[model samples]
Target: MRRPRYYTPTEVSLHNTIDDLWVSYLGRVYNLTPLVEEYKGNILLKPIIENAGKDISHWFDPETKDIRTHIDPISRCVKYYTPRGRFVHVPPPCPRSDWVNDFGKPWWRDGRFEVGLLTAKTRWIRIINTLTSQEQMLEVCSEDTLDEILQCYLYYNSHAASYTWKYDGVNLDMSKTLSENGIPDKDEEFYQCLMDRDLYTESICLYFNDDLSEI
Candidate 1:
């Protein structure tokens, strides 16, 4: 049996109007807020909104050290940020100081581009969570959870509507040029464009027809 929620549906809506008057942290400015905003319009917001309260606040609030913190790492697995202002996987490589001198690693060779926040934070947070005696603190997600995180990352990143294409052969249609040059099976039907006049003459003559005695 559950006691009545003080903020019922009607009360919640009215309170929402009042809450709107308060600084929203996300008022119209996209960059000013965290990635959590993009999640609000989602269908999942219903359950989350319904449950959000003073209790949930303690979770997200830095000072509370609530149980929500442990779950937050898992809940937020899908989205994270990079230091460059780009949202990527793994937090951006630590600032140069933290990388070579402080952390002592060749972070550059690690392909620092895919760096994101969730996984990186998980590494340190797990240690703290384990050593801490508090049971309410947030726990880190397991390695197996990375795939799901990546899936969510891709879904959110894929929303961009525009794209760019290279202009290599827009005018001349260089399919034949590519096939004849070095592309595999250019002589067959796949890249018939590679079999064009200038291509065949240029590539075929340059290599196969050249004098072998010089070799």
Candidate 2:
């Protein structure tokens, strides 16, 4: 058996189009492109389309009576649909056996279209101004690079032009990974980085003056 692949929420969000729909439910990612194409105009299609490229756990959650009632028909459809009546042989009701193991938990269990696991959640990091002690939290993903984080901060804080960032007393190297720079693991609530004086003043001046060497 092949090992299961894992994907981040951001990775799954990229497949939001009708031709490449994906959704996360109970930490599992499902690629519903084939089903979406097969049931394009069916009544069951609405919820899938509405929740495409997003998590739908709350919709069919076992504790929720409202969405559960709504999903019952979709589950029954999956259990009984026959494709074009070619009748060579009946394919299993659901593609995967685990899906068929439980009928009442959620309709997602009735569809055997899982793609991978949703492994990463958005993390918030605190970027503190060392000079003024002012702090701001920024949302980022595990796959984001230091450069991307810096760019986000710069975009949000206009005063970033006057400051640079430091992690654990060292200058934040834009080329480094967040993990490499000691950013905490997932759900940490708040990881901190210090804002320091920008040391690139001379380099910026030289670059503007057409000095490629300093760049």
Candidate 3:
């Protein structure tokens, strides 16, 4: 079964620009660049633009999984609570004749803008090549499979896919997560022991398979 892609906060933060805005909320990440382009000249875009490449989880209600709401002080009626002012698709606090509700669905509820889910946790891992004795420290998401981790390792070793990965003397299942492969995350233990996070990393040895496809 295919799993959803996971993104670290650092990867999402890099897209903090007008043409590539991204934000995360409630463990989900969204690429709001289209929303930005659709409402380019609208002043309601201020908050979204200013907050590009950031997490706006506070803008939503965890249980309801929707935008936060509050009662209108003067009218004694409930309305969308936007301290930064209303943005695109959000109805005005008060009803207005010009307000239109024909946009099909609100951007927040639209899944089209969503890119992927945020990784729940991150940990340091060291990858060492048995062939050349090269080593690199990498921070990886707990939910990531070995194949995904290999993609990150490509920066260090271009022949990562040509290697057989192993934790100890046993071979690893590339389709499964690190935990599923019996490699437990020790980040919490490292933290409790006051160990230097930089010095504390799980070692994964890679043996060359002699595959020449990458060459």
What's the C-alpha lDDT at position 77 in model 1? 49
Candidate lDDT (C-alpha), each:
0.24, 0.57, 0.88
> lDDT tens string, model 1, 1-215?
73111111222223232123111111110111122254435443342344322122222234432112122253444332221232211233234442223333321222221112221112101101112222121122222132232222233333211111112222212222222223223234434655443243211111112222321
lDDT of 2 at 138: 62
Q: Model 1: residues >4 Å from true position, as ranges?
A: 1-13, 17-41, 51-55, 64-67, 71-215
Candidate 3 residue-wise lDDT, 16-91, digit = tens? 9999999999999999999899988989899999898899999999999889999889998988899998988889
TM-score of 2: 0.42
The candidate with the higher TM-score, 2 or 3, is 3
For candidate 1, which ten residues in a row score worst on lDDT? Answer: 21-30
Residue range with the least summed lDDT across 10 consecutive positions in model 2: 200-209
RMSD of each: 27.4, 12.0, 1.7
